[model samples]
Target: MPEPATEEGNRILSLWQGSWLAALIVGVLVWGLLIWAIVAYRRKEGDGMPEQTRYNVPLEILYTVAPLLMILALFYFTQRDQTILTKVDDSSSHSVNVVGWRWSWAFNYEEEGVYDVGTPGEPPVLWLPVDEKVTFELTSPDVIHSFWIPAFLMKMDVVPGRNNKFAVTPNTEGVFMGKCAELCGVDHSRMLFDVKVVTRAEFDAHIADLKERGQIGKLDSGRSEVAGVS
Candidate 1:
């Protein structure tokens, strides 16, 4: 059966293909040359064995140099792809703080001045502008947990004492589901949230609407209600 491919799996596949093809070529050439050398140098069953020239420095060098160059080329491209794909360009990117509580995710858009404090019915949904970079500063309020959004192809561990930083840019605009990939405790299964990627205008509208609805912050009337009671 053919193996399935994923976006990340594809990147890995390409990296392996480079080294495998080079090795395959060398293997076939080495085998063919060995056959030819064995046939040409072999002595008849009854004939005395010819004296052997044990080692050729040039031949040994050729074998060593070929594989070494292939390996170096493989490492070079692998690292290049890693840096290009994962490096964060913060200057042009927006920043969000993703905090993992006991069993919830709160995606705070620090740049937008909105922080959805993760209520029960309304969890913090990360709204990102498609094709734009966004930096995530991840931390956990208690215990260890993991933050993963598979569709965007990034994940990192959230430690209580440390803040993890990474970046991603969604290529397609859509709602991608993410969950606490770690087993934090009994309620870990319910730690779910969605990442919404929209256009810049739509994102602005969403924050405005969320703010108005008292989802991101206390709505104007709700605030006035509290003031009236106090």
Candidate 2:
């Protein structure tokens, strides 16, 4: 699989892979101890009753405190990563308004006053500059949808009534695949797009191209806000 394209994505991936490794190590140790105890304490046919012992306070405390500490560690890391991923930096270099429709997407460059609308077969391309943070405010006109970029390892819901926003700084320069991870409608499977990360000059040129093609206008879906929280 392709590695994550953004710093935030890389951070998340590292955390995820690290957690999995920790879990595997713990699982192996615990299982190994279980098997050892089963074999070592096995009773022979002529063996008498094993020595009866009441509560081992130290062992009980170890099991309790050890699991508590592990859980606290996991919680801390998860919360930290989530905060880093969802942090919205208003000072981003570029801002795009993402609208998820029935089976397509609309990328509106709010600052540039240009928008790119996608169709079923012909998906739109979102352009961004490498090493620059881009802010995306996502919403939906009808039902719920998701904006998922596989290479970025980022996905957020596009709800009809609210705006969900996130920021990503592309560290790699290349084209990556993007799609709607949520099942919104009949044509949900066809909702796809491309993310092109390039140099600042190339990004500017692409915007100019969009402008030349007369794709320079604000998007108006005419749908009323539903007051639902994102």
Best by lDDT: 2
| Pairs clashing within candidate 2 | none
Report the lDDT tens digits of candidate 2 across residue range 111-207: 8888888777889899999999999999887999999998998999999899999999899999999999999889999999999999999988988
Number of the top candidate by TM-score?
2
Which residue pairs collide, candidate 1? none
How accurate locally, in lDDT, is each candidate? 0.70, 0.87
Q: Which stretches of candidate 2 lie over 4 Å from their true place?
A: 49-55, 220-230
Error of 2 at 181 (Å): 1.2
RMSD of each: 7.9, 4.2
Mind giving the per-residue lDDT tens digits that candidate 1 earns over 176-218? 7778888899888777788888988998898897678665532
Residue 74, model 1: lDDT of 79
Q: Residue 32 lDDT in model 1? A: 97
| C-alpha RMSD in Å of predicted model 2 compared with the true structure | 4.2
What is the Cα-based lDDT of residue 215 in candidate 1?
56
| Model 2 local distance difference test score | 0.87
